[model samples]
Target: MKPSKLLITLLALGVFASLAFGQRRNQIEFYGGAAFPLAPETFKDYTKVGLSGNAQYVLFPSPRLGITFNVGYEAFSTDDEKFTDALSTEFTGQTASYWVGQGFGLSPSATVKSNLLRIGAGVRPYLTDPEANTQFFLLGQVNFNLIKNDFSAKEIPYQYDAVNDQLFFLTFNDEEY
Candidate 1:
């Protein structure tokens, strides 16, 4: 994300926080849970259901109205076999004549991650008296979601030999190209 966009987002959240919490009705909430994949069959096939966590602050200025601010993170790990197969299929279907590979044989040192950050704010309106110990509410929220993926497979270790009309790959000890 660009600095300017991030700045704007922070400013917006700050504005929401500045709204008052009155009558001594304020709470902090935290949650840790699993993230399920719901869309795009390919994504579900390649990535496992992963971890998610969140924290939020809620302030109630009046007995019936509450404002909330939240921050959250989510992560998903890919299944190497499925992910590599998908990539290879896509690459070969394209003009990847110079490329011939099924998988990278990525070592433990290789890193691959898909992560997300969420910042959001919302209003909660109490169905019952918030001043009472028991309360019910409806919430409506707007969120900004940012995703980052890090993929470092190290060297792919694939080289094509024109004379031999073949591809040599995953051979770390073979120095003579």
Candidate 2:
């Protein structure tokens, strides 16, 4: 089975178990933390640190077991890089020759930004008694994430060949996807 489906099944089971045999205590909590990329090499030139925040509402049917509903957001740092490439034109119907301009004059650069929204359910089990001043718990959660990416590119100097009526530089101008 898919990982997401398996996670949902476990969360549902936890919720149902808590509802069947647990006392009623409702609580709300807010959390924030830094997220580290598990596979930083996959991202190439991007930063590895991300910021994350979440809010959760818990319903306890028993002193030890609780069902939680959570909503969260995460933002990854932006990364920028420069690339160099050449554009060429081909001539036909007469003497055919390719005109190529290769140099650092066309400095192209790009920036990438990523963000995510998360919604999920989980089970939290308290290790200590409910009356303790400090409470500790083991938590398991299943989250569905919506991801957004913004990619933009630009050329330092736009170049055009009027004789061939061709624009040598092209860019998306800070578009989000």
Candidate 3:
């Protein structure tokens, strides 16, 4: 099935379940999981991995389901820095090493947060705890992510002086990289 159709189906199911379940106050939850980039071919000279986690609160509109408010963190990483260094080092006798840190994302969605895994065509399943006051669960969420690329690490630069056949090395702060 297409992503758009699947998303719409999940939304409809969420609404139905929320209206059927009623409301509860002790509905807080926490979850952690990892994500991977889907379209690596779209980007050349880059490889990405995504990591994620969340804390949630469910507010039931009706017994079986509720609308979930989630605050989450996600990350994406690429090898662009290394690729760039490779291209530059060939022309000059200097070798440069660079490390690219991860990229991050945040997700918020309207979906059903429930304990029971409804069996059938359009139901979404949620992982839950029946025995804890402050519960922990895992729910798969489909969301469009917005990424902010900040944060970097230190870099090292080295040069081979071909004329004198001598080696030189320099260290730099995160800002220079």
**Which pairs clash (backbone N, Cα, C closer than 3 Å) in model 2?**
22-61, 22-62, 23-61
Model 2: per-residue lDDT, tens digit, 1-177? 999999999999998878765555688999999966564353434645799999999988788888899999988875453221211111111110121233334445556677789999999999999888999999999999887767666652245566976545556655633
Worst 10 residues of 1 by lDDT: 168-177
Candidate 3 lDDT, 44-124, residue by residue in tens: 234455566667666654333345656667654556455345433543433343212211121111111111111111112
Best by TM-score: 1
* Worst-scoring 10-residue span by lDDT in model 3: 108-117
TM-score of 2: 0.63
Candidate 1 residue-wise lDDT at 71: 98
- Whole-model lDDT per candidate: 0.65, 0.67, 0.44
Residue 104 Cα positional deviation in candidate 1, in Å, after optimal superposition: 12
RMSD in order of candidates:
11.3, 11.4, 15.6
Give me the displacement of residue 28 in model 1, in angstroms: 1.1
Candidate 1 similarity to native, TM-score: 0.64
